[model samples]
Target: MLEPAEASPGTQAEQASFQGIRRICGFIAENFREDIDCVDIAVSADIHPKYAMSVFKRSTGMSLGEYVSLMRVSYAQALLMRDDASILQVAMDSGFGSVSAFNKCFRKKAGMTPSEFKREHRAAPPPLHA
Candidate 1:
């Protein structure tokens, strides 16, 4: 069950806190392709890093670093789907400092190396029937 905003001070504070979390998450999603950090996100949300981290963890059940890693891996997945990008380029574009680190993380998250993932996805057959 959920309480209405007008029901109590606690409810109102909860609502405001939820909104703040959403703003922070949205900012991260939008800028995840860039080199970003907890401080950057906290500044964008007009909150302190420690407070932002606490709020984000409460709402997302993950730390800001975990969220960023997931976002970066997701972006890499999208880039890997494209034929125009090399794995190294995708790594750099997704804000990883080095290809080895990117490959390690990609393997951890996607269960394969970036090159293998890209090749498998790129080689998939399209549906024949409409």
Candidate 2:
């Protein structure tokens, strides 16, 4: 499946514009672990903060904070599903500053607490075939 920009446009300007946003998105994905703000992200993306926020929101349909939280919650959810990493480990590794924040976001996004998610989603051992 193609992204909207990839599927709908082939113009050079469109491609360039898309690339700029992609660069920003990539930076966010890579560095959301650290404390990152819109200004820092904008600097990494080589654009002004206000413009970056506007562009990002327009392109992605969410504010930068929302996107970062979404990304963190998503990564944390994946770790939780594995059921090996501790909740605190998942929180830190997934870029949350604290367990409380991670839990709040996880519940908002997944409709369950992190521990509950892990417990419920943990895969059962394969049936022991004789």
Candidate 3:
């Protein structure tokens, strides 16, 4: 019979860290449409806020706020494509407090303002039947 190799201490630590990161990500995904902060994320993941910030940064190379902003902007992009909603409405729906913030973050990550992105990427309408 083949014996299973025991995990080393480093591997075990890495596993724990991975689990923590997963929990943090889950919380963020579930609540990204709300006004969530590091303290909220930490509480959901059962870690100290400061520790959560460090772990998130170490694993994702960005702060919690940055991740949240990314999620919001990405969502806003989809909304802009499919909805005729105004930019302010899309920003609010995507969890941004204001259109300026939405435009700034969207431009930072997507290389264009929300309006520009919508103009460039909105889907064309289907042809009418004869």
Which candidate number has the best lDDT?
3
Ordered by TM-score, highest first, the candidates read 3, 1, 2
- Candidate 1 ranges beyond 4 A from true positions: 1-5, 123-130
The lDDT-based order of candidates, best leading, equals 3, 1, 2
Evaluated at residue 50, the lDDT of candidate 1 is 97
- Give, for candidate 3, the lowest lDDT window spanning 10 residues: 1-10
Per-candidate Cα RMSD to the true structure, in Å, reads 3.0, 5.0, 2.5
Q: For residues 1-130, could you state the per-residue lDDT of candidate 1 as single tens digits?
A: 6548346888787777787788888999898878889999999888899989998898889999889888899999988998788988999999788999899888988899999989888745667996
Number of the top TM-score candidate: 3
- Ranked by lDDT, the better of candidates 1 and 3 is 3
- lDDT score of residue 63 within candidate 1: 93
Per-residue error at 27 for model 3, in Å?
0.9
Q: Against the true structure, candidate 3 has what lDDT?
A: 0.89
C-alpha RMSD between model 2 and the true structure: 5.0
TM-score of each: 0.84, 0.83, 0.89
User: Which whole-number lDDT from 0 to 100 does residue 69 have in model 2?
Assistant: 87
